[model samples]
Target: VLVASFAHFCSFDRCNSASSSSVLLNALPRPADPAPGHLQCPTCVTVFGSCPQNSDIVTCPNGTSHCYNGHIAIRGGGISSSMNIQGCVAKPSSFLLNHTQNIGVFTVMENRNQGDERGEDWNNPIIQAGAAPVSAPFLAWVVGLGLSLALWGGAPSLPVLYWSGPCPHWTS
Candidate 1:
């Protein structure tokens, strides 16, 4: 009976020690990691993709525009007349471990065609074999007009009227 009581006392003491240590751990202040400021996007809620680095031409998959700093950005169109973005969330850190906060969504103005890769013609073929003739339609129109003028001696002075509508009521 004394051995059992001693074992129970040892377990109770262990439990009490664990609870006391947990309380102390909770009381300790967590380390203050340097967090980024509140990020704001001038366009939408989410951003284009990964936080844009120092690149003027960042084409996010979601079509968001990013400036140098992740804080300010534009999407869809120009800064002057684009949707005001909100909820700029922080991006994952370079180490891929901690994310302090989200950076805002970036917006690209409609008229701001700067840095757009779509304008480049790199993929377009310079010369295509057996391509449709460019001026064929124009040549046909010119030939048809010339033949009509030669055969009819030019258009009539008065407009040509077609009597396709029902005849007007002719009262006796």
Candidate 2:
């Protein structure tokens, strides 16, 4: 009889503690969600055509953080068409930008700015399809050196090397 009474008390105590903990959990507050950002970008969709004269600028929905611009041309299986698109995107496309190629039935190109290309935008001074841009720092240093030399009435003593091809009249 003593054991039975002790077991009943222990069970009651356990249940009471569990309920108290549950109440504490319920009373604790949770961290609130972050507010969404307001980012606007151009939005357009064209099929076998170009973007309209005045494409719409739209507020990107939450989680979309890029402005996408791409072109895709399909020509196979009796299908010949192209699609141009510009819009707010969650991620940028992986197509090569500012270049053209023939790949199976799909010729894809992308010319989007993904917010990271701020100072190094590809179109500022214009560049060829497959050429690395000259470093601005190097150019600045060269210009500074030239100006300093000009101000000092100095010329480079090193010979100007100009051998475009094997010297035209020389035979090896």
Candidate 3:
């Protein structure tokens, strides 16, 4: 009877151990490069007036193997503005690369993420898309107005003139 009970207990122990080992394996981080020829990196998109406030992970297109982040300034038509952008770019032989367009120039600064040392989970969604762009001219106007008002000695008010004559409703 003792031997039979001991065998039953051992079987139960083995079953529990196998289940726990599987759970631990699932919890462990997967290998960084699960597939070949595909590069994944952080991406951010910002229009000159409407820039993204944060970065997120994105899979790079074929032939592009580097992540880029920086600002682009555009000046013309009496309007000057700038935008911040980040995304995949063709791997360059040098650290920084500049490309000029008809409207403006794009400056790229490489952002490297390897060995997962940066502690960034590229699989998760970092930032939302379609962020509204702030109006530069509107902001400038508000600041200028505020400064003019301040220098003008507070808000304007009308004088409280009082009449010396008796009230029309009063009788002598």
Candidate 4:
């Protein structure tokens, strides 16, 4: 089974709405972190395996325009594993894809291109390594539906798999 890793928000000094001391507040302005908002996306990072169905939704940073989903496979020595990432990005990135490289961590091979590693004859996949076969849109839809069902009395008996407070930016 794939385990989904969730990052929970912890408050820091800046997260506090008002500083206790008026003198301290007057001296230097402390910039506040962006407030959590509705631009939410499923966030998870799974190391060397598939991710879980119940991922935590989080608010994206101010400039983020797209939700990113990526998979990276690593193979070298006796180790053969992959990493999965899903989060918000400022923009959509074009996948480098099927090409391979030796830059380390069994590097290269980025992108979401179709086709295979070698060719039709070799029959190797270029996209969706590891647990990514589930497709991002489908995954998001499933998660959204579950959340709605759990919260809107659609399924009052259905428990929320994971719940957290206001979703801060990527940091949390």
Candidate No. with top lDDT: 4
Give lDDT tens digits, candidate 4, residues 36-88: 43344555656555445455545554655455556655454334545555555
Better of 1 and 3 by TM-score: 3
Tell me how candidate 1 scores on lDDT. 0.19
* Residues 1-172 of candidate 3: C-alpha lDDT, one tens digit per residue: 0000001123332232221122322333332332222444444434444334344444444555545445545444333445344444455322222342442221223233332222223333223347432211100000000111111122321111111211111111
Model 2 alpha-carbon miss at residue 113, Å: 8.4
Q: Which ten residues in a row have the lowest lDDT in candidate 1?
A: 138-147
Ranking by TM-score: 4, 2, 3, 1
Candidate with the larger lDDT of 1 and 4: 4
lDDT of all predictions, in order shown?
A: 0.19, 0.33, 0.30, 0.35
To one decimal, what is the Cα RMSD in angstroms of model 3 from the true structure? 32.6
Lowest summed-lDDT stretch of 10 residues in model 2? 138-147
Which runs of model 4 end up more than 4 angstroms from their true locations? 1-38, 94-100, 111-172
The predicted structure with the larger lDDT, 2 or 4, is: 4
lDDT of 1 at 77: 15
Error of 1 at 109 (Å): 39
| Per-candidate TM-score against the hidden true structure | 0.14, 0.35, 0.33, 0.38
Task: RMSD for all candidates, in order, please.
Answer: 37.3, 33.1, 32.6, 17.5
lDDT of 3 at 49: 40
